[model samples]
Target chain A: MPGRGLNLTDLSYFPGCSLESSARESNISMMEAAEILGLNLIELEDWNCCGSSSANILDKEIAFSLAVRNLSLAPPDRPLMAMCPRCLYHLREAHQRLKEEPETLRAQERRWGRPISLGLSIIHFLEVLVRLGPARLQQGLVRNLNGLKFVPYYGCTLFRPPSLRQGSYYQGEMGNVLTMLGGVPLDKALTQRCCGSFLSAARADVVTPLVNEILASAVAAGAECLVTSCAMCQLNLEIRCTWEPRLPIFHFSEILALALGAQDYEGWFTRHLVDPRPLLQARELIP
Target chain B: MNPPAPALNLRGAASPIVLAEQDRYLARDIERLSRANLSRCFHCRSCGNGCPFIRGMDYPPNGIIRLVQYGLRRQALESHTIWICVGCHTCSVQCPMGIDIAAIMATLRRLALAEGAMIAETNILDFHREVLQSIKQYGRAHKLGIMLRYKARVRQWFADLDVGLRMLAKRKMDLKASRVKAIGEITRLFIPHWKR
Candidate 1:
C-alpha cells in the first residue's frame, strides 16, 4: 500500500454489499484490474456486509454495530478496501465514531477479539489506485478513452457524511484517477449531490426529478457516459432510467479495468437493466 | 398565457356519484405523489445530465419536459418508468427545473392502473409487496425466504442463480429467522392514506 504500486505479495481486499448483490461489475472489474496489474488481491476467506445506509437509516448505533462486525472480520495488519460508498461511509464512520468518543471506543473495544481501540486502516479501492498514480494506470491501459466524454458520478455515499474519512477519500481520489485515465472527469461542482442513496425507497416520486437533474446536466456538459464508485448508484440508475438518455453508466473500476484491458465487455456488463453496450460498441471496445 | 387545467374528470370511476377535487387523480393515491409537481418544470434539463442509468430509457428522463408540460400523460405511462422505477429520489433532488419527476412518475403509475395503462412488468409492484411482506415478517429482510417466494411469484426463477448457492455457502441466510411475526401489529402499519 505504501511503496509506489501494490506489491501483489502483500495485497488484500473485502468486496462489499453493492457488489455482492445488484452491482456485481465492480467485483469483477477490480479483480480484472488486479490481475492485469499483477497485484494479487487476497480476498478474506469469510466476509460480512458493511451495513450500508440501511443500517444507518434510523440510528447510528445499529449502523456502528454492523460496521464494527464487518471490520472485525478483517485481519489487523492488512488494509481493507471496499467499492460501495455506503460501505465506505459506514466503515469509516464507525471507526471514527468509535475512536473519537471513548464511550463508543470502550464499548467497541470489548466487542473485538483483541481490543482494537486503535482503528483498522480501512481504505476505499479508489484510494489504492490513485495513490499508485496515473503513471501506474497509464502503464496498465489497453485502450485510450480520449474523445469519449465521461462523467464521473460519485453517488451520495462516496463523498458524503463529511465527518467520515473513507467516504471523503474516494470522492477526493477518484477525480485524480479519472484525470489520470485520460478521460474528461466531469468537473460539475455539484457532482456529489446525494443521488438519494437509500432515499429512493421511501421517496421515489421525489427522487425521479432529482435523478433527471443529474443526468440532464451530465449530458448537457457533453458527457457521453458516466462513471460511479458505488454499487447502489449503479442499481438505482439502472432501475430508474424509464426515460431515454443514451449515456452508459459504468462502475469506475470496470471502466478503469476496461481501459487497462484488465476487463472488458462481459458478465453484468451484458446484464445491465439498461444496455450500456452502445458505448462499448461505439468505441469498438466490445467483445 | 397559462393553459386552463384539462377538463378530464381525473376523478372516481365514472360514477353514479360525482367526486370532489381531493378525490381526483385517483391513481395519485397509490403512488402518493402529485401531478401538479410536474407543472413546475421549465425543462432546464438538469436531472437527465447526472443520471447514471440514462442509457436504458426508451423515453430518456428528459422527456419529463414532453410529459407534463405537453400533457403526454398516456405516452409517459406506457414508458418503462412504471415497470422499472424503484422510487429512488435522486432526480427530485437534482432537478434545477424544480419539477418533481418522481411525483410525476407516481402520478403516472397511479394513472396507469386507473386507465389500465399497459401494465408492463407486473413484477415491479409485486416486488415491492413481497419486500414489504418480508420486512413485516422479520424486522429485517430474510433474504432467502423472500427471494425464493418472490421468484416463485414472479416466475423469474433463473434470475440471480448465484444468490441461493452463495447465501447458503455464506450462512448469512437462515430459514429459522423467517417466521411470520406479530401479523396484527404489522398489518396495522398499513392504515389507508398515511402513505408516501
Candidate 2:
C-alpha cells in the first residue's frame, strides 16, 4: 500500500540468512528483477540474523533483541522490504512487540545506540509488486513464459501466522503476477504446504515424506515446476525430494527475472540441486 | 455430535492418570506464554489431521493441548510432539477455534528445556544450538560452520554427506561466514548479566 499512491522507487531490502548464503540465486535474481522494474533495493547495512526460528526456539529474549537490532539499523526514510518471509515475519513480529512494550523498545534502543522508527513499514516483495500495479510489470515484460505450468509455493510464515494477519495477505499474488507474465498458475496442489522448515536439517526422515507429498501433489496437478517466494522452501523442496523426475523448484525471483529477460539465469539455474534448465528449454522459455 | 475418539497411545497412557497428580499450573503457564486459550479446543482432531509431522510425533497437536489442559506436566513436556513440531502453523490455521496450536507447541518446547525434561529429539535441539552458535559468532548463520559443528556434536559424519557435498559443489555453502561489523555488540548480548 505504501507504493500505491506514491511511486516508491527505492526501498531497504533484508535478504535473511538463507538468501545471503544457500539461496544466493534468489537474492541475485530478486535484485535483477527489481532493477529491471526500476525499483532500487538497498541492502540493510550490517544486518544480522532476524532471530531465526533457531534463536526463537532456544531463547526468546535473544531472539527479540536480535530482531530489534535489525529494526534499529533500518533507515527511517523508507519502508523496509524483505524477500524472505520468515525474516519479514520476525522483523515485523519484533516491531509489533516493541510497539506494545515501549519500555522494552527503549531498552533495545539504548542497547543498540540507535533509535528505531516505529512508523517504518515492513513489506514483502510480492506486496510491493502488487502495489506497483500490473502496468509497471507489463512495461518490462521481455520474455513470455510460454504458459509454463507451475505451482505457486508460498510455504508457511507468509499468511499463516496470526500476528501477521493484519498485514497484506499474499496468498495468490504469485499466481496473479505470474499469470500476467504468460505463465499458467496451477492451483490444485499443496501450494501452502510446509517445506519441512528446520526439520530438513535434523530430521530429513520426517521432511522427506512431507516434501514428497507436496511434490507429488504438484505433479498430480500437472505442474512442471514449483515457484516459491521463500528461499528456504525453494532449497528444501529441491534438496529434500527423493522422488524421481523431480520437479525443478524455482525461486519466485528467478522466474520473474527470467521473464524480465535477465541474462544471468545460467548462474542461478546452475546452483539449483535439480537442474531447471531442461525444463526451461523444453518450455522454450530459455535457449 | 460425533463420539469422542479413543485416545492415541501417548506417554503414560498405559495407566490411568490420577487427577490429583496433575500440576494444576502447567496449562495456565502455557496459555499465558502462547496466548492461545486451550479451553477453546474441542478435540475435533483438525490439528492432528492437518499436521504435516503428525506421523513423526508421539502425540498430535490437539493431544498435546489435552495433556497441558490435564496438567500432565511431565508427559506434556517429555512428549516427542513438542520437539517434532517446526511451528509451521499448519495446525494453528486449521483449528476451527482460532487457536495458535503452533505457538502452544513452541511454548511446550521452551518449558521442556527449562524444566530439563528428557528431549525426545536431541538431534533437533543440537541442530538448533549449532545454528544459534553460528549466529552468535558471525552475527549471521554460516551454513557450513553450523553443519560442521552439528555433525561433530551428533557424531554422524556420514549422515547426509552427499547433500553437503552437493551444496558445496553448487557453492551454496559459503566457506566464510558473512559477519556483522560491530560484533562486540552482538557478543555482549550472548553474555549473561552475572557474567558481565
Candidate 3:
C-alpha cells in the first residue's frame, strides 16, 4: 500500500512443473489471490520446463535451451511472472546468459524455430507482491490473522549468487505480505537456509538433517506456521521432516488467498503431509 | 606371529611433488569449461563451510577447487561432491572470491558424464538421466513416468513406497505426461545439442 493508486492489471504467469503437479495448491491459491487483487494472471502459452536443479547439473546447454524455450513463449510486452523460485532463477539466469552470449541465443533460436528476444523480463511472484505493497494488500484483507506468528522461509533459489536477487536477500517481501494479512512475521536466522532441494530425490538422508534444522529453528523462534515461495522447498520441508509437533508449511500465496477470503482454501490443505488446518482453526481463521 | 614389514628408505630421492603435464592441461581445461578463474580461489574454506551437502562429499568444495588447480581431473570429476551438490547455489553465494562454485560443480558433472569418469553416486546420475528423458518425451516433466523410470533404473521401486502412495492418495501424482504442441521443437533442441 506504499503507493495508493499503484495496481498491476495483468501479468504473464509461468507455473513450473511442480506447480502443475505436486504444488497444485500453490497454483490454486495464486490464481485466487490474483483474483482478489484485481490482477489478471496470463499464463505463458506452451511454456515448457525450466530445466531447473536437474538440467543445469546434467548439461548446461540443455538447461539454457530448455529455459529459452519457455522464454520464447512469453508475451513480448509483459514481464513473465513465475511462482516457483527454481524456475524463476533458471529463467533469469538463462536470460542473463543469453544476453551475454548472443551466439548461444542464436543457436537456441534455431532449435526453438523462432527469433528469441531477451527483452522480456522474468519476475517472481514474491517480487510482484512486494511491489504491490503491504498497504494495498491490507486494504483487501477480509480476515485479520493477528495472532498467527509466521516465519517466512526463503529456501535457496530466490536470493543467491547476488545476481538473481530482485530485492533484499532475505524474503522481506513475504514478511510484508504476512504483516499486511495481520499475521506476525517472526525474524529467524535460518530463513535463507537450504532445504536440500533435489537431494531429497537421490539422498534423503542428507536432506533430513537440513530440513530438521530449518524446522527446529522456526519452532524455536516461536512460529505458528512457516510460509515460503518455493514449491520444492515446501515439498522437501513438509515431506522430509516427521518430527512430533510439526509446524505447518503454507505457501505465501495460500495465506494471501485465505486473507483475501477464499473459501475453498481448505481443499488445498488436504494435500499437505503435515495438516495445517488444525493450526488455522486454532487461530479461528477457519470455521 | 606376524612378519615385520621392511622400512622404506629415508635417503634423499625425487620428491612426489612433480606435476604431470596432463594435470596442468586438465586444470586449464576445467578453467575454460567452467569459465571460473581457478586462480581466484585463495583456498578459502568458505564454500566448503557453507555447503550443506559437504559432510557427505568425498572432497569438499574448496578441496574440489584445489584439485582443479592441481589438475587432478579424475579425482575431481569422480568425487561424489559434484553429484551431491543439489544445485542450491549456497557455495556460489558464500564464496568471497565471487566465483560461482555451483557453476563449476555443474561443469564438472557434465565433464564426468561426457568423459566416462567414475561416478561415485550412480543413483544421482540415474535420477538426472530419468528426469531429462522424461522432459525429452514430454514438453514438461511427467512425475509418474519419471519416478517409474527412475525406480526401474535404480531398482529401488520400494524406496519411498509409502510417500509415493501418500502422494497418489492426495492426487498430487499426474497419471499422464503433458506434451506441448511444439514438441518437435524441443526434440530438435535436444537431439542435436545433447547427442554430442
Interface quality of candidate 1 as DockQ: 0.04
Model 3 agreement with the true structure over A141-235: per-residue lDDT tens digits: 99888569988998887877545764344457788777867899887648888898877887888888888988999989999889988888898
Instruction: At residue A187, give the lDDT of candidate 3.
Output: 76
Ranking by DockQ: 2, 3, 1
Kindly provide the TM-score of model 1 when superposed on the true structure, using C-alpha atoms: 0.59
Which residue runs does candidate 1 get wrong by more than 4 Å? A1-9, A101-106, A112-114, A117-119, A165-172, B1-196
Question: In model 3, which residue pairs have backbone atoms overlapping below 3 Å?
Answer: A1-A133, A1-A135, A1-A136
- DockQ of every candidate: 0.04, 0.83, 0.62
TM-score of chain B of 3: 0.84
Interface RMSD of each: 10.4, 0.6, 1.4
Of the candidates shown, which would achieve the greatest lDDT relative to the real structure? 2
Displacement of the residue A247 alpha carbon in candidate 3, Å: 1.2
Q: Write the per-residue lDDT of candidate 3 for residues B26-129, one digit (tens) a residue.
A: 76887788788878999778988888887678777877887777676777788888898876788888888988888788788888989899998999888888
Error of 2 at A47 (Å): 0.3
Name the candidate, 1 or 2, with the larger DockQ value: 2
**Lowest-lDDT window of 10 residues in candidate 2 chain B?**
B4-13
Residue A33 deviation, candidate 3, in Å? 0.3
Q: What lDDT score is found at residue B65 in candidate 1?
A: 39
